[model samples]
Target: MDGITGETDSLGVHLHYDLGNGDRLQLLRLATVAPDQPLAALVPLDGDGLDRLEAIDRLLRTLLGRKIPQDTRLTPQQRRRSRHMLQAIDGRMNGASYRDIATALFGADRVNDHPWKTSPLRDITMDLVKDAFAMIAGGYRTLLRRRHRGS
Candidate 1:
């Protein structure tokens, strides 16, 4: 394991496994294992347990050089919205008005098609900006784990 290292302490061992392409896994080992034994995950049975397990599975797939399923990944539409959210947030920080941001995002034609005061794009742009601000303020951590249907 060229890229694997661990530190032992009173609490436990903290293992840092780094991959070639810049990805890294920070695993905590609760107990010592034999040299030839495989590592295992200790997941808590709780509301977010499934999401945590899925994240571990994804990490294992990456380490094993296997393909992670696309469905478990963010969809194209979701990715686009994330990109737009970041863009809108950046525009606002750069002193661009909501109308200007909307024009850049949805284009001048779509933004100009409706009255500025009542344009749907205005609302969309505002929501994106608001959501992005929340994300910047630590809400992005919530997006890391998949939520339950009603969660």
Candidate 2:
């Protein structure tokens, strides 16, 4: 499994790899500009999976309101491992620097220095991953509840 890192405006979100199926573990944000935002959420599909990656690409482009550079395809591996989004947000919010917060949350040795490009597209992609999982999880949980009640 790949040790993955992604960030949204310096909020310090990360995605680790899962050994079993190579799925991205989830994005975890240690802090945020607003108190209401969640700390973490899972992406439903593997970060390297074709459908999910394409979806993410489209999502980022739309959110940024600009076309991805013609040569840029935005492969999942790229998004799965990026930490720029989190750092950028931190920069905007005047919060603790990314290095400090990331070190605190993920340990000093583990934090990498790769930069992530932040835009509306990146934000949307992060959100979509969470939403996709919630919708599915909610359906299954509801079904389980109904089944237990019926029994």
**Evaluated with lDDT, which candidate comes out highest?**
1
**What overall lDDT goes with each candidate model?**
0.85, 0.44
TM-score of each: 0.77, 0.20
- How far residue 115's Cα lies from its native spot in candidate 1, in Å, is 3.1
User: Candidate 1 at residue 84, lDDT?
Assistant: 97
TM-score attained by model 2 = 0.20
For model 1 the local lDDT of residue 41 reads 83
Give per-residue CA lDDT, model 1, range 114-141, as digits (tens). Answer: 9999999999999999999998999887
lDDT of 2 by residue, 1-151 (tens): 2354565545555544342456554555565534356343235654334445554565455434667544234445544433433444344346655454445445555554333244334344445444444544553333211112131
> RMSD to native for every prediction?
2.9, 22.6
Candidate 2 backbone overlaps, count: 20
